[model samples]
Target: MNHMKRVLFALPLLVMASSAFAAGLAVTNNSGLPIDELFASPAGKGAFGANLMEGIKEGALDDGKTATISELASGTYDLKISAPDEGVLCTIKDVKVDGAALTLTAEQGKACK
Candidate 1:
């Protein structure tokens, strides 16, 4: 290959390499309550969104609340709800997000117990 041809070929490859990146998830809460905490990692992401009117704390999560999570990776996650200031409550539920939306509702009695 000529010098000019080589340079042109290499330029495209470099651009492609930089643009390639891993996937990511977006966490949103519209349950009319404040989510305690959200857990996300390179492996995947877990979300806990819910309404606090039903015995749930406003702008906070008490014992149990409404929650919904999505965009979880293809693995296992120890998911729980927290107050973000007072730590966690209820129990740590073992959740699985297989590269799709995993809708979850905060529960008191879980299988982990």
Candidate 2:
């Protein structure tokens, strides 16, 4: 029937919408040092993708600032925060982003500095 066909067509779209809605990552900068770039990629991938959040005119992310990334698929990702000079400030591994949004905070410390 036409009604049955319509329901079948809409099922896939509904599933896609649900999956996309829950795939997001939020990064908060509390490292004291300014955040100049943000990198994310699948766990164990080693290579990081493009900057999810771009700085302002080569500037850095101020303290208490947050960046949201919604384009990534649902999976575990490794996150790295770096300074404007391309120095690694913080590295968080095995960040799971499943059917919900994940929040990551960068704290100030010897490891992060």
Candidate 3:
């Protein structure tokens, strides 16, 4: 009975900890251009992973529009935004993401190319 009680007591904490591990990012395009691609990488990794915008049904994320990237683990990340045929428009670094939806605007980016 004591073991069962202990297990039940820890169950909710386990659930909360698991939920806290999942994170998401909400990006708003404000760079005065349509964003054709967006990528997120663990901070300081140098190489970016997948294009987060690939799943969007409306094509490019137009200026002033927002998109959410889900299923990411909570951590620091770097964001790369690009325009169609324009190469990299900007890269935003050191974005801290927790379980809450973190918001980013294009104006926060640097190193346009």
Candidate 4:
């Protein structure tokens, strides 16, 4: 019975700790172009993760608009923004995300080859 109580007490702490490591990112498109796709990966990782724009209802984030990406963990990341027929617009490197939410602007992206 004592062990069961201890386990129950620890369960909520575990849940809170797990949640603290994962967070949502709010990206604002202020680059003067529509963003058709968005991808994020851990910093220094060669490959980008799945397209984050697929979760948006409009299928894209237009200039001056904001969208929330809910699948990120608290850490540094690289962001890739692309447009249909325009290829990759830019890539933003070393973006730090922490806690429950972090906001970023697309205008910070740099030209990529």
Give the top-scoring candidate (TM-score).
Answer: 4
Q: State the TM-score for model 1.
A: 0.34
Worst 10 residues of 3 by lDDT: 104-113
Residue pairs in clash, model 4:
none
Q: Which lDDT value does model 4 have at 5?
A: 100
lDDT of 1 by residue, 1-113 (tens): 69999999899998877644323333333323244655433323445433222332344433434333333556666555444344334334465556544444434223223
Provide the clashing-pair count of each candidate structure: 2, 0, 0, 0
Poorly placed runs, candidate 1 (over 4 Å): 1-23, 26-33, 40-72, 84-88, 106-113
Residues forming the 10-long window of minimal summed lDDT in candidate 4: 104-113
Ten-residue segment with the worst summed lDDT in candidate 2?
101-110
Please provide, for model 3 over 33-112, each residue's C-alpha lDDT reduced to its tens digit, 9 standing for 90 to 100: 67888778899996888887777767887777877655566789887778866565677789787745555554563345
Error of 3 at 54 (Å): 1.2
lDDT of 1: 0.43
Q: Give the TM-score of candidate 4.
A: 0.62
Stretches > 4 Å off in candidate 4? 1-24, 85-87, 99-113
lDDT by residue for model 4 (15-87), tens? 9988755545666777666788878888889589788767677778777788776666778888777866556
lDDT of 2 by residue, 22-75 (tens): 545555566666677777788988889888765344356666676565466678
TM-score for every candidate vs. truth?
Answer: 0.34, 0.55, 0.61, 0.62
Q: What is the lDDT of residue 44 in candidate 3?
A: 94
